[model samples]
Target: MTKPIQGFSKLTKEEKIDWIVSNYTHDAESAKIILKRYWNDDEALQNLHDEFIENTITNYYLPLGIAPNFLINGKLYAIPMAIEESSVVAAAGKAAKFWLDRGGFKTTILGTEKIGQVHFMFSGDADKLKSFINSVETKLRSEASDITKNMEKRGGGISKIELRDKTADLDNYYQLHCTFETLDAMGANFINSCLERFAKTFKQEALHFSEFDETEKNIEIVMSILSNYVPNCLVRAEVSCPIDELADNDTDANEFAKKMIQAIEIAKAEPHRAVTHNKGIMNGIDAVILATGNDFRAVEAGAHAYAAKDGKYTSLTDASIENGIFKFWIEIPLAVGTVGGLTSLHPLVKLALEILQKPSAQELMQIVAVAGLAQNFAAVRSLVTTGIQEGHMKMHLLNILNQLGANETEKATLTEHFKKNSATHSAVVEAFENLRKGI
Candidate 1:
């Protein structure tokens, strides 16, 4: 067993790597070589990466690919995606091209409200607590004015704050539920700062309230934090065309539309299926989110929660064919920002935003939603027609070839061979060996 070391974080980068490999790795030299291999050649750039987090190691890289031909709201965009998955970018591109001539994706911003709370415990008269809150509401806003001034100047600030009595759920538990308009920023820090200020002001005011007794005056503030679940921050994206335009070389127009609707219905009905179904949608959303330096984890949490908002887990998308028109759409909660966090620091993130044409937060929400919808559309079209594995495994062929250590000639030959046959692992291995043997 490896022993824990003190002041490990205080060690120099080289010393930290030396210690880690000496204790934990079987081949210390190989481990050290691999770690340093990923370091940025530019010393200043490597230093910038090291400062992004604590106990820094060599940077991890993901391929940044472009999925062009996204026509959202009558504007063309070549979306950038950073993901490790093989077929995601290709699928998104294919979806975009399919809709490019069909009026493309249309998006709407339904709302942009975010939430935070100051949870506290109060064991006093409920009416008195309400009166105390009502009295100090203005004080709470005024105290946090310094923090909200810049946001207010940008047409976004504290929207509303309300006191809620939750004694029925937990003993003497209460909350100062607050909502905000953060505009182009995700505003986690802003919301949290405002919440802490509110908690401090509320606690101070409680001590001076004439009607409050000792227990009520000593209100124990549990925590002040922003919620990742922003159900009100929502956008909707949809694509539609005449049923005849939905046809392809292999799939009938009317049958394809009906099958697409049926697949969505199945996902809406079954949790097991819905999980995978929504995961396909996230494949696109998360790719763009990561590329653009947004919080994919936060977006993922809020999106799944919204899917289950109606008491059950279901599909995030819907489809229908009515009066000869095929339509599909997705309305999802995505709280993303364009001006903060990695958007300003990471070089690739800056490039990604520039590729997106420097969209505002609401516009970014719409684009993200459309990415998800387009991805799902591509996946479902495959599932109902040629089957998903056909395209997915075809894209995955390169991975398999690389893993098998195929030479350039062998890889090229096998790739062409698989185009005329199946790219199964065993089949590729056999073909690769035979090719190497000149058979």
Candidate 2:
């Protein structure tokens, strides 16, 4: 086993990549090979290579910042999140501080079972078809069981099969939900593979269809698809802070809590607001998802779909203040993994998993739940006070300066001038020249 990289944040961009490559089973040459294999465009590949040299692989690195002072489930952790958004890390840190000041974040994960869907299109009677599916449940389970034998040996396998009715269209469509215990893996591939195998067996043994193909029958099988209505496997986190911890003289801490709740309610009421609201939650969760090389797109799709499950858009996080304490909670569909796929192939992702010290998939989900809740806290706190643009623009100025390539001294002068006045690119250039002449 390779020893993990230490003090990653202390290293420069180049040093960080070097540390990741050196510690993992990959080197610069190997990284290049992997990059070329994925990216076919010569110019795009060159750009990546050039950016790698500049230590600007921001996509792979941004969420790596450590969230300190977090004590979840009575265990201390220094969590590293990779995200592009501003204020996420700061917000999580502040929330962690508030919780630690009281006790800490108390969280629980209810097993890891992701739902896979196999859509069946049958012309037969709905009642008879339903009976047929139920009759073959055991056979389907056995088929699923055989596919996940490895996971079964590791204490994870198919747990249940559920059927849902769909009569919105002229054609009758039945959805088969295969629930599987994923153990410490996200199990998208596993679930989909098992569902396909079960579908094959269902047609061969039960449906009596000599020729059944997932594509030909218009039978769509999807894995790890977002179901906000996911059965079980919910991760719940609660953080209680003394009312004084949320103190802001402008608003009573308890009143502040009410306002936070009200703001979330507003997001819950309107689709427009809920989009931004859920985006805030993803701003935190997606970072960790990406860091661990999980499928963020699938996670995002599922979370948003879940938010709208009740036919009304709403915030996924709920906040309350009671008896001189403020509490925050969120339960979102976070299907993430610690091992397999990119976690095994990507060097940086492997390094991130190492930094996380190889947490179980369930434990990882709870941590992500905390992050989503923390992100909501941050967004709400900002919306309630100081407006989002104030801090966002302050951080965005660095990018504007970098685009202009201002040196350290130039950057400081430019930043100062920009703060003093609504500085433009012309103004920045003028400041750059003035500072260069030592005028």
Candidate 3:
């Protein structure tokens, strides 16, 4: 059994590594080597990575790829994607190239209102609490002024503060639901700061208000935090072309459209399919979010919540054929910031945003939405035509080769062999064994 160590974080990096490996693992030296092997050569760069989070370990790596020829609005963009998945970037790029001449993608920002909340409880009169909140609204704003001033100057700040009674949900539950307009930033810190200040002001004002009796004055504030469910903070991306232009691989356009629509409809109605379907969309969304240094966790939460906003989880995408034109689109609540957070700090994040032509928050939202739509299109197109595994497995071939411990010469031979044959794990393994036996 391993004993706990105190102040582990205070130790030097090597000492920390030694403590962990010696205490936890049998092969301490090898484990230590693995951790240190990933460190950057440049000391300054390594220091930058160390400060990103606590408990400095070696930097973890993911491939940063580009999906080129993404024409949105009128200009072209080469979207940077950071992901470990094999086929996502390839599929997105393929979809982008497919739609390159067909007017590319068109996007519209439906709204940009982020949200946060202050949860509290009061065992006193509900009517009195409501009236007290109504009268104290100005005070809430005034108290949070210092936090919101800079944001307001930037044309982004608190949009509204409402008193919501939820006595039925839990004992004396209430909320100060606040809405915000954070123009060019993700606004998590901005929103939360305002909420905390508002919370402090809320309790202070309640205690001093003349109308508030003893019980009402003791308003207990549970917590103040930003919400990730920004249904109103939405963007839409779509692609449309003549129905006759939808043909592929000598397949009829109408039939192809019909099959794609069915696939989407099935996803829209079934949870099992919808989960994977939406995951495919996130494969694109998360990659861009990672590359641009936005919070993928918050985006994922908001998006999934929005998908089920209508009472049941469904597809985030839609497809249709109308007026001899085939159309596909996706509307997602994407709360991303082009400034602040990791966007300016991380070197790769800055490069990724620059490569994207330095879009505003709204433009970034549109670009992300387009990438998701394009990815889903590629997935559906493959699903309804050639099947998903055909392309996915091909992209996954290298991973399998690496896993099987194949040398460069053997991997090359196997790669060529799999191009003409199936790439299933068992099949590849069997083929490798047979090839070794001169078969």
CA lDDT of every candidate: 0.94, 0.71, 0.92
Badly placed stretches (over 4 Å) of model 3 are: none
What does the lDDT come to for candidate 3?
A: 0.92
Worst 10-residue stretch by lDDT in candidate 2? 220-229
RMSD of each: 1.0, 10.3, 1.1
The sequence of per-residue lDDT tens digits that candidate 1 reaches over residues 209-289 is 999988779999999999999999999999999999987787789889889999999999999999999999999999999
- Candidate 1 contains a number of clashing pairs equal to 0
Write down the TM-score of every candidate.
0.98, 0.76, 0.98
How well is each residue in 1-439 modelled by candidate 3, as lDDT tens digits?
7877899889888888888889888999999899999999999999999999988868899999999999898899999999999999999999999999999999999999999999999998888888898899998998888888998998889999998888889988999999999999999999999999999999999999888888789989999999999999999999999988887678789999999899999999998999999999999999999999999999999999988999999999999889989999999999999999998899999999999989899999999999999999999999988889888988998898788787898889998988888788788888878877889
Shift in Å, residue 420, candidate 2? 8.0
Error of 1 at 245 (Å): 1.2
* TM-score of candidate 1 relative to the true fold: 0.98
